[model samples]
Target: MSLCEIVRLEGYIQSSYLAVYPDKIMLLDGCCRADVPMVLDYIKTTLKRPVTDLKVVVVTHMHPDHAGGAHKFREETGCLIVSADKKKQWYSGIGGRTMHFVDIHLGYYVARRQGRPLKNLYYSASL
Candidate 1:
């Protein structure tokens, strides 16, 4: 069996894992929206692979630190998004939208605490 290399990428507010195989790549956790460029750069420049090689992105949860970059990745690379099958989005309705906003701010707070510059972490609540 072939082995895959797992690389940990430091995100804006958290870390994400990238599973690299010869033909494809999978990202564990979407990471913050601000981290999209960094992740893509790593795949293209560091890994020396085409961005389209990113085949899957698993969003473990609907938080800014976990699912923020999912849609952007899909849009940029045409990658598939994998997540829990749920009837409704985790962030739904007025209250859920409020919480989504709060969560993004919370991510910013964490970045500030880590001495990182604030970045745009806003993502659509529904995904």
Candidate 2:
């Protein structure tokens, strides 16, 4: 049988799961944009693996803490982002863009409430 280990990496506002195998890795969630460096470091330092081993990133939702780092991950590791195929984009029009901005601030509020230090959480509304 093949062996795979799932490790939980604590992010600025949420936790992300990494499924590690001999030749591949998968992120269960996108995590916060502030967390990209931390997650990449963990994979390279702790897991002793190349960043390219990260093959897939599954975004559970459009929330800042859930999909914020997806584009960064793809840009860094060429990982495929998997999410629900919706008929309409969540952040489409001007109002939707405003909501996206509000959501990012809300993420910062949550991090502050959790006693976490402020970090850059800005991400493109269009995924």
Candidate 3:
């Protein structure tokens, strides 16, 4: 039996999870880019592991609060970045890129019009 340890990282307005499995580490919601240091420190100190040990960084969506640190995490950890779902079109090539851009920008525009910050809005689960 494998024990999975899940840690909820603090300080970020958006909640993020670090799930440590026996053989793999999966980060759910990369948090803001500004939270990178805190997240990395938590993984190293609390988990007693190096950043490179992370196997996957799953970004639930392209929202800044959820995926802002994904690029940095990938660059730093050399981990594979995967989407939360198996929908190929939703995360695959040109179409995926276009969709992400459209969704994020449209979300921002709507939030702005409503006098709310996008970061304060909770993104729906991809699944």
Clashes of each: 0, 0, 0
In model 1, which runs have C-alpha deviations exceeding 4 angstroms? none
After superposition, candidate 2 runs with Cα above 4 Å error = 1-3
CA displacement after TM-score superposition, residue 25 of candidate 1 (Å)? 0.2
TM-score of 3: 0.64
Local distance difference test, candidate 2: 0.92
In candidate 3, which residue pairs get closer than 3 Å at backbone N, Cα or C atoms, i.e. clash? none
Q: What lDDT would candidate 1 get against the real structure? A: 0.92
Q: Candidate 1 on 63-124: residue-level lDDT in tens?
A: 99899999999999999999999999998899998999899888888989999976899998
List model 3 lDDT by residue over 1-127, tens digit each.
3748888876344568888887768888767665677888877898888888787888776665677677777888888888755645343577766666666666567556757544533332231
Residue 123's lDDT within candidate 2 is 91
TM-score of each: 0.96, 0.94, 0.64
Candidate 2 residue pairs in clash (backbone atoms < 3 Å): none
Candidate 3 regions with alpha-carbon error over 4 angstroms: 84-127
Residue 109's lDDT in candidate 1? 87
**Candidate 2 at 87: error in angstroms?**
1.8
